[model samples]
Target: MLKLLNQLLGLFCCFLMTACSSVPKLESNAIAPIVKLPNNHEELGVMSAYSDPWEGFNRRMYYFNAKADEYVILPVVAGYQKITPDVVERSVHNFFSNLDEISTFINSLLQLKLFVAGETLARFTLNSTLGLAGLFDVATQIGLAEQNEDFGQTLGYWGVDAGPYLVLPLLGPSSLRDATALAFDNLVFQQAINELGLDTDEELLISLIDGVDARASLPFRYYASGSAFEYEHLKLLYKKYREIQVAR
Candidate 1:
């Protein structure tokens, strides 16, 4: 139950940050700070550079995750979309995003990011009260931007190696260090929910709702990259994204 909940929790948080952002223009100018890579960059087998010591198991998990997405997650999200109005959906997104700041705040302190920690705390406080328990994100308009921190980033900041690449079934790309961090965070979250005197079924239902809300908000479709080797392409991207995030 915790494993499934964790997967949905990650999904909900992932879309919360990006859903309000504008889409990037496909065209790029020469003076752009970031270089635009062609979609077909993987045609050159650039994914070969990614080292996956546990490729055998990771591949199997990736396959399992893909099947779960198609047969289970997508159908539920479709029904959720049919029932939920846009405004209500956005409110759910905002509420979860605000709750996520709790995790970010703790991780920010763990990494000793004083400024970020303060900002996260301030965002949580302001949004929780003034924003109507996080159903609205008035803080963003006032400039307390979200600082997307997690224990994985915290561990990375402390010089912990990623250990090994992993593709958890339904959880997607993660490293050994990140996986451990995720488990720790989930345990804390579960304990907190238990302290509220909720039964196991109620907790699981909350997790399901969170996952469905998040999955409904997502814009991406599984294996929609059109790459025959989509798995490797995503694996490489996940690795590089983590490296850059840790560097920040």
Candidate 2:
């Protein structure tokens, strides 16, 4: 049962990572200042340079995650999409995203990003009340855009190195530091859920429903990117994306 719960949790994270898989185009002028890779960079050399000491384990886990997603998760998501009204799905997304703002606000405060912290606090308050428990994104409409922050970014701000690339059984691409942060964030979220007076069964039901809604909204399909080197690309993209997030 514990294993099943962890796998269910993975669907949510997998959707999140794969949904944002598009690599941002770096300006040619900015590359020198940022990455500082050699002018004569070789594709193979760069790919090989990506640190993945646990590649053997990671590859096996990645295969398991992909298969679980293809067989179990996507079918449920498909069924959910077929039955649920579009507006209801959007509300579910908004509601979960609003709950996430709590963690984002806390992490922002930890990183001492007072402006982001303030914005997140205001956004949560406005959305919870004016947006009707975040069924609507009133904050974004009113120019209070959501700020994305996490404990991983907070650790990064304090100069914590992304230790090593890791592929969790269902969770997808992460690093030692980020994985630890993920666990921490989940614990904090569970505590918040408890404070909201939800019983264990209610929390579990919400999680499963959230996973379905999340996977339904994302367009990513495992092994569908059409790149022969999909694994390598995924690793690089995730790393670079996290770097960009931390930089911001």
Candidate 3:
């Protein structure tokens, strides 16, 4: 059990070094196909109004995460993608995304987004039932678009300061609030699956599947950002993205 937990932790740290929030909000005027921290957000994401005091530590962790992704994480994801049929892959993606709405639903209420909480409930209901347990994304087709919410965003909504940038050992870039939120969310999530009848092993396996699916969906590659300044660029983008998420 300890070995499996360690392996899963390593996989998560390596595979997902990006995005506290889901992929950035879509924009009609956005130029980037991936839509992370839209260039237009010069007020914050272009550069930080605040400073990264721990940039030295962040840079080392960034390098470590990049190498891990290249050598361990991406290779595994590639193999999984190669073997899985596209339809099956899509189904796996949707199923996990649907399950994530449970967190979104709770976080929406925390953030006091009553309309969004309601929307999340409706989306979860429609997807789980009409969408075949979220394997088909029927909710999206019907217009109850999935909204990503998390405790980090909840704190932000409540006017909690981000309180300096910090990169977690396996979690990559995050503020103090987001990092703490991550830990709390994991605890809540574990209890949730426990109630749903997942044994520890089954829960770990499911988490693995979800992580892989999310990594597979991203358009970016580790250390392949095509610029020597990629790290700086990512910092700016992450800041901008999170700011938008908070203020939006």
lDDT of 2 by residue, 1-248 (tens): 12222333344345434433233456877644565655445533545556899999988998898899999988888888889899988898898888888999999999899999999999999999999988899999989988778888889999999889989766688888988898877876677667778888999998888677766766656787555566776676577667877889
Predicted candidate 1 versus true structure: per-residue lDDT over 1-248, tens digit per residue: 22223333444434333322222455665455386666655454445556799999998898887789899998999988889898988898888777778788888899889999999999989998999988999899898888877888889999999888888777788889988899867765666556558888998987788778766766556666555565665666577767887898
Point out the higher-scoring one by lDDT: 2 or 3.
Answer: 2
- Measured over all alpha carbons after superposition, the RMSD of each candidate to the real structure, in angstroms, is 9.7, 9.1, 11.3
Task: Name the 10 consecutive residues with the lowest summed lDDT in model 1.
Answer: 15-24
Candidate 1: what lDDT?
0.75
Query: Residue-pair clashes per candidate, as listed?
Result: 0, 0, 0
Which portions of model 2 show Cα errors greater than 4 Å?
1-44
What Cα-based lDDT does every candidate model obtain? 0.75, 0.77, 0.73
Best by lDDT: 2
Model 3 weakest lDDT span, ten residues long: 1-10
TM-score of each candidate structure, all chains considered together: 0.78, 0.81, 0.78
